[model samples]
Target: MGCVLSGLKWPRTPSKDHVTPEPLLPTLGLTPQQQQLLIETWELLKQDIAKVGVIVFIRLFETHPECKDVFFLFHDVDDLKLSKELRAHGLRVLSVVEKSVARIENVTRLEKFLFELGRSHYRYKAPPRYYQYVGIEFLSAIRPILKEKWTPEVEEVWKVLFTYICAVMKAGYQEEENKHNEKTPTMKRLEKSQATAM
Candidate 1:
């Protein structure tokens, strides 16, 4: 026992890099059953994330052609050139929602995250109302995939959750709009002063 103890080495500190990821979001507004179903559904979809992403953007374009003009990435994307850019954009958007869902219990985190999303989206000048189509099209994309498991209850659950998500995002959009308006004349003056200095 004494010899074995002498040979052993133990560290006095835990590794800093071993921080645990934050636990998945709480059920929040949904019931326990609803939360379980959603988690299961997301597990299923996440397995085929790339494919679902492809389906989402494709459906978005099919349903709302005008949404294409809102993003600069879509400007050069003709019908024949859909897959590459659309797939990348689709994955990015879905990833954000996945993170939001993971932190569902943390409404503050979700709102802050999406608020930044909306604020940045202001650069695209995308109308706030247009984001509804994404929820619609994403549901349409996932419906057939979920098939037999996709019940009316599932639809209602997603509807409630996404509606909340969109509302938070819209608040973010409004914040950016307010700042933009506040900067109106100051932005012009700065530009004019820069021209004079040059």
Candidate 2:
């Protein structure tokens, strides 16, 4: 069951091209005026997503000692100290999705980006399921700082963002599987031909 679940795709990439078209405004069940207010609130918080990333990393390491090895592998760091390039890369990635948080606009481009990201993540061998854990931790870290500014509208935006990201990863995994399957056919044929010759 774990293997089956793990095989399922989750998108980890964010794309600028795929904006959620129908804005998350409606999902919050708020009036247009209220939605506008929520958008403004999100704008303010969005600027801090990078900062939130730092806090999330800290809290994650503090709570999950065993997980430190995974982080080290993914980040190429024996300790918590992140390099400037790594920090910049993280901020850039977060910024891409943060820009999409206010609305549900472009689905296709977003999905593609996420798919690529998921495929890339495989190199680090980070547990595929850890995406959700990171998302939850990110929200938890920022929620308090956001205080009254954190509206349902904002949360809805995050939901869409995460959902889109996970979808991409799911697709990426399937693509990987398909590629492997393609190779297997040739390998099996070769094995059968050799057996028959013997």
Candidate 3:
């Protein structure tokens, strides 16, 4: 079921290099019925991930050129393959969430999902400030397809997703800082010396 939903392919070799970790699922705080609905929606949307990935990548590239460096760090030929894998994973996750809660009848569960997603954005190392841009781009990209179908529910889902994504990024940054602080004496000394000289 996981593989089917993720569109995973078999690797030729068992190389340990450049492994991207799977994303953590957002806690939905849902009822049993909601959980069933979520699963159904996810299953339905799994087929659309590739198209969604392309749209997301293009939109990010076009609207946030500054982010190219971060995204392109893995732009090498081999890394391109990995990038595609990562993008597909991201798209699958997004599609599941989008479809699951896009028209949820319960506002509280809906809001909870949104809040967590906003937090996840920060956790995923997305830039803290650019979430709004991403949000706008996402809405714009989907708006035409969903024209006249848009509702407050759809808007709320996006709001939550981007907000959580940004939050997740911010958390990642903080975690990075914590790691940096845990460096050995030599590294700390070097950093301190550099700071003093500057």
Candidate 4:
């Protein structure tokens, strides 16, 4: 690891001509029971995906204040109150989530979609840990909607699902980073900074 900028540690920047690596993660499988829980609960929540999405962002930003920098769209809308743009963003995110959950049974397509998702998120410069926090906040946000149905089994299933999702996404991020590392520009920047610091 090296300082990305302003001494904020980041993985070393890569060269421009670097080749993209093969997928860094194996496919993750969910049990039929786990898939059922995620799909069923998600179907129940889709009716108010906006509300749940709003809650997810609110709770996520509340829990992780530093995460706001990653979103240029919502960068200025820092508070819990949902701005129109924030709401729209939330809607888009949840809509995607809804679609992804629907594809849970089709692991091949799901992983491919998630890899694309990871690349998009990398463009936002959002770290993988933020995804983890979002996963946690999702469960918390949905707990009320689920009411009595939010059982231990449900919680465990979601947690496992998020882990799998994040792993694949991180793999995508790492693949990009590897390509970046093969570039000269980033390497020059890193070397110059390290030299000055020394």
For residues 133-178, could you state the per-residue lDDT of candidate 1 as single tens digits? 8888889888988989899988887787787767767777777787
Task: Per model, state how many residue pairs clash.
Answer: 4, 13, 20, 8
lDDT of 3 by residue, 1-198 (tens): 465645667565768785645344343344555444444533544466565555655676667767566554433435333466657655754664564355355545554455455455545655557656655666665655555655565555556555554554444554455566679999999999999999
Model 3 ranges off by over 4 Å: 1-47, 73-127, 130-132, 182-198
**On a 0 to 100 scale, what is the lDDT of residue 37 in model 2?**
57
Residue 152 lDDT in candidate 3: 67
Q: Please, what are the lDDT tens digits per residue for candidate 4 over residues 1-198?
A: 544594864336666866545865765577888889899988788887888888888887777778787766776764546488778878887776776788899988888888878777777787687888878888888899999889999888888778878888888787666666677997879889999999
Best by lDDT: 4
The lDDT for every candidate, in the order shown, is 0.76, 0.59, 0.55, 0.79
Those runs of model 2 whose alpha carbons end farther than 4 Å from true positions after fitting are 1-42, 73-86, 99-103, 185-198
Steric clash count of candidate 4: 8
TM-score-based ranking, best first?
4, 1, 2, 3
TM-score of 3: 0.47
Higher-ranked by TM-score: 1 or 2: 1
- Residue range 1-198, candidate 2, lDDT tens digits: 555555666334647775434212112234565445545756776777667766666666666656567666434554444655435645764665564443434445555566676666665565556666666666677688788877686776556556556556655655655554668777979988999999
